[model samples]
Structures are given as structure tokens and as C-alpha cells.
Target: MILFDQIIFGPIHSRRLGLSLGVNLLPIDAKICSFNCIYCECGFNTTMHDSPIPTRDQVRETLDAKLHEMVAEGQIPDVITFAGNGEPTLHAEFEGIIDDTIALRNKYCPTAKVSVLSNSTRIHKPHIFAALNKVDNNILKFDSAIDRTMKLMDQPVGKHINVAWFIEHLKKFDGRLIIQTMFLRGEVQGEKLDNTTDEEVEAWIQALEQIRPQQVMMYSLDREAPTQNLQKVSVDELNIIAEKVRAKGFDVSVAG
Candidate 1:
């Protein structure tokens, strides 16, 4: 079953961060986010709505208990990850949750790092950025570099958020900005889908130069996606893309 079928999973394994213990900040049915990407493994949000946000105390208690249990059982996760059924930042009490989780992680697993898997939509928020900076890994999503293409692929809530603005704002962040991109080709709403084109990749590469992220996390779909037409880029293709990005002087990791 998909990991989110439960509130938490892993310390299982990760290509980038080893032995990650997941922390699901979103409630069971409150999997809300700004994007409706076709490749999301949780499938598209069924409600198309945001929620009565989960409490910070609730997340802290659950996470603290889990950490304690793992410690007691001699299970030491490498990272305490803020990733779950939906974007962790959407939880209104996100900053508090991050603070609480970090404290608990230090108390139980001092060697472990705290990380987040975010969409970068909330990067503009001062509070969110402050919390993100505290994490060991800030895995932010930037699926496409072209505005029109991004709108179709990510389907974000605010129309004003575009590639240029994203790059400009990302400059404010002090910590390592781990860019996570999904390379795929698939049909959405009866149209052909392809981000594998030379033009698209070139745009992404150029944008990457401006952002100058610490590293790039490139991967393709491996789980059931919202649309059937979406196709994963092969390992050879992923490696080729990584090589090109590396040529420009940035480290890249192939997750798939």
C-alpha cells in the first residue's frame, strides 16, 4: 500500500536521506494543498478545498510518541521528515509543528536531521521560510520552468505565481534549496503532456542557473498517477538530464 495509507511510514529507506521517519502534519481527510499536479501519488485532491487545519499540539503529540517508541525499540531514523498526504505547510500551525518536531528529534535522535518536502508555494510567507531554513533538507518542487506549462502541470491555486517570480523569491531563502522535479509526459484534459522536450528542458536549465539551488532531485513517476497517459522518463534519460544539469555546475540526484 502507498505509505500515506497510514499516518506515518518509514525509516524504511530513501535515496537522498537515509532511514527517514515520516511525520504527517495533515489529518486523514484534510490532505489539502495549492497544486493539483497530475503526477501526485496521493491522487488529485478529491475535495478541491482546504480545511479546518490540524492542531499543532495534535501533530506534536503524535510525532513525539512515535519518536519515543522508535527510540525504545532501538530504531534510530536518519531524518524526521515533514512529508505526508499533502503539503505540510498548509497546516496553519506549520511553524509550531516544525519547532516541536525539531525539539523532539533532538531529544530522541540528536544525530538525525529534520527535513521537509514542500511545493514552494508558501516560500513567500516569512513564517514559512523561517521554519524551512531550520530544516536540514528543503526539498521544494518546481516541475516546469515555463509559465503556461507550469500552470498546466502544477495547477496551482493562485494564477499570479509564475516561474520568474518563483526564482526571484527563492533568492530570499538562505538554506540549501533542494529542487525536486518530476520529468514526465502524459495527457491531461485531452491534451498531450510532455516536459521532455528540448525547449522545456532548456528553460528549466536556464531558470536553475538563476536559482542556483544547492542540489537537484530529479525523478519520474513510479506509483499510480492521476492520469493514465503520464509516462516516466527512463533511467538513461534521467541520467542524461542530470549530466547536463551537472555540466552547469550543480549537483543532481536521480531518485527513481
Candidate 2:
């Protein structure tokens, strides 16, 4: 329901990335993503538009202009984030755009970090992997470690995706990636779903050990989700989960 109308929309405060400037590569009026997540703030993928994605030149021009303006106003952001309508890596010129963004950030706001929020669906693509490696924060999502729970939660576009395959693919990043997970419980359609259970958490912890990310970001919903059945997990529960992950010798942060 929150559709961004411009390529550069905010220098808004982010829970993780402070004073962030959002870059939307997808269509302005609709959601464009590979996953039809039940808790997506932009609603379901079925409601997305058929509009063509923005051109590399268009993104370059818009982002450059915005950075110049922010610099002149002495309002440089802490981070330039690639997140908006949907999965940003889906852009045809994603690699070129990342190059452009990095160049502009260096010129106008040299101290600012370049970050990308990816669904981790396209990491197998050589170009996408290379582009992600160039950014400051290569944040990837993995909500559940169990195949059945992942299928129920993420609802990925490709039915061939499985937890085992996904985990193996994630290990390709080694320790360079930042893993982000959203903790919640609810029922969609008719089946009961919960990822905070000991079984789910233990499985997720084991997977994280294999991937061995630099850090893990754990949080619960803070906005109205597309699915009304979802319930936000408490902060105390999140801390407990974070501790479990921390006990494994990996750094973890909890957000509610």
C-alpha cells in the first residue's frame, strides 16, 4: 500500500541504516518483486504494475541530481539504500546502476555507504553476485531455515527453490554477507505457521553457522502487513532468539 512515486524518495531514518536515502529501480506506482511475501508492506505481487523498469541513464541522472542537491543543502545521508518498490537486482542494468551509484556517492557524499536489500533469489547470477560484492552492505533475506516453513513464509516465485539449495547458495557469500530475518507468527489460508519455535530457530541457527555471515539482523513487523493474520513477535522473544544466535559465536542484532 506504500508505493514510492520517485526514484529517489527519502533521506528518512531507517531502523538499521541511519539517515538513509532510498533508491527505487522498479515501477513507481506498483510493486515489482519476485516474492509474494505475506508480510510485505507493498502488498502482494499480483497488485504490481506491468510498466517497464527504469533505464540505466534515467537512474543515473536522477540519483546524481538528488545527491548533488543533498550535498549543497548539507544534508548528506549516512547510507544510500537500494530498496523501494521491490527486488532491485531484477533491474536489467543493475550492475551499471551500482557502478553509477558508487561513483555518485563517492563524488557527493564520500562518507556515505552504499547498501542493497536483496531477496537472495538471484545471487546465483554471476553479474548480480559481482555487483553485490562491490557494495558496503550486501543485505540478504532468509526468514526460515525449514523448507516447509520457508515455502509458507516467503512464497517465492520459483517452486524449485528449496531450503537445502538456498542454504548452499548462501554459503557462496562466505562471511561477506549480512543475513536479515523477520520473526513473526500467523496463519495464512488455513495452516498454522510459526518460525519462532525451538525447532525453527535451531534449524535457522544451524544454517547461519554454515553461512557464517558478518552479522545477523533479526526483527519483527513494525508496519501493517499484507496478510492480516500475521502477528509481530515481541522484543523479549527477539532478544532470546538473538542470544541463541550469539551463543553460536556470531554477532546478532534485534529490532522490533
Candidate 3:
């Protein structure tokens, strides 16, 4: 499993966000998440640590030190991203951390954009919603328009989370949200699942029309997914889906 031990780790090149610096708010040794997704690169949410999550002050201090060093070395990142071992919004001090990150970004790397990669499960929280709105890129995951496919792919912690309710809640973001969808096919425990199918794509496009996001980022699996049965959708297939999404009169991009 790939895990980030430092609070501030990568300054790696990303297909979506260039030269991004990553901030990991979750515990260094374990994965603490609200969803147990099958495709998570960090592996399953198996280790639940009781130890206190990184405090607001700790995050501020660590991030400040990193950013200062980068600035001194004349190596400013293109973006400062919140993506680590698990759900960033799950942290008790998430809002405060966002505030700190923005401050650090402004002081050290004014050109860098602040971004958060969230599962959208916690959008119901007022504070989380507010923090997400403050970021330059509020990327939220939307794997499928069908509840059954979502359950099979994401395996959200909350069993009650269905697509209908999810769409209604996601609409709250409106223009600020960037919807990210993963296109893939696989069978888990004898259940066949594929979100790239015509029926699935049509339903998803309908949902996107209602959500009206700033943009849609569709991509296939790039690394080894935790679920071994999954297959990556080709770039050609992703572009085909992107074209369909664009036909609905929304901005769309494919990264495969």
C-alpha cells in the first residue's frame, strides 16, 4: 500500500494539477477514512487508530516549514493539495487546516492554487462545505449515477448514502464544484460492474446536467487498484465518454 508518512510529502507532477505539493492530514501510520473504496490506492480502511489526529497547530507548523523551504529553494508548487491516506474533511481541525494552508500558500507561493480532493460524503457538514468553498479547486468524487454501482465501486461507510440524495447534496456546490469520475469495469464477489456502459453514462450525464459543475474530470485507473478484479478504461473510451459529457453543454476533460 502507498502511504504518505509526512504531513507534507509530494511536489510531484500530476496530470490534473501540475507540480503539486501534497498535505496529508490523516495519521502517518494508518488509513482513517469514512469510505472503504475498492479502488483506493492507499489500500482499504483497515487500521483505525485511536491516537489523536494531527492538530491544527501541528499542521500549520509543518506546512509552514515546508513551504518556507520550498520558497527559499525557489521551488514553488503549482498547487497545494489536500489528499492523503484518507478523507481530509474527516479531521476535526479540517476547517482550521484549510485556513492555515491558504495562509501559507499566500505567504510562500502566491501563484499556487489550494485544492482539496474529497469523496463528497461529508458535504452535509456546514464547516466542511464552507472550507471546501474557500479552496481554489474543490474536487469531489462521483463514480456512478446509479446507487447500486456506487455501492459496488465506492463502498461508502454510510449504507444510507444513495445517488439521489448525493446529487441533491452535491447541487449545493453548484458552480464551485469540480466533479471527478473514474471510468472502469470489474467483478467483485460475482457482481459485474461497469460505469462506462451506455445506460450508466447516460444516467451520469443527466446527473451532471443537474449538478452543473464548473468542470468534469473523467479518468481511468492509473495505478494498481486495491480491487484486483478491476480493469482500466482506455484513453479512447474515456474521450468518447468526455465527448458525450460535453454534448450536454458542460466543460469536460479526460485524463487516462
Stretch of 10 with least lDDT, candidate 2? 44-53
* lDDT string, candidate 1, 8-62, tens digits: 5666687778898887776565456788777787777657434444588767777
Worst 10 residues of 1 by lDDT: 1-10
As for candidate 2, its clashing pairs are none
RMSD values for the candidates in order, in angstroms, are: 2.1, 1.1, 1.1
Query: All models: lDDT?
Result: 0.82, 0.90, 0.90
Q: Each model's number of backbone clashes?
A: 0, 0, 0
TM-score of each: 0.93, 0.97, 0.97
- Candidate 2: TM-score? 0.97
Residue clash pairs of candidate 1: none
lDDT of 2 by residue, 1-256 (tens): 6877888889899998899999999998788788888888887774646666789999999999999999999998999999998899999899999999999998999999999999899898999999999999999999999988888888899776788877888899878999999999999889899999999999999999899999999989998898978999999999999998999898888888
- In model 1, which runs have C-alpha deviations exceeding 4 angstroms? 1-7, 48-53
What is the per-residue lDDT of model 3 for residues 1-256, given as tens digits with 9 covering 90 to 100? 7888888898999999899999999888788788888888899995666545788998899889989898999998999999998999999889989998998888989999999999999999999999999999999999999988999999899876889978998999877999999989999778999999999999999999889999999998888888888999999999988988888888988898
Better of 1 and 2 by TM-score: 2
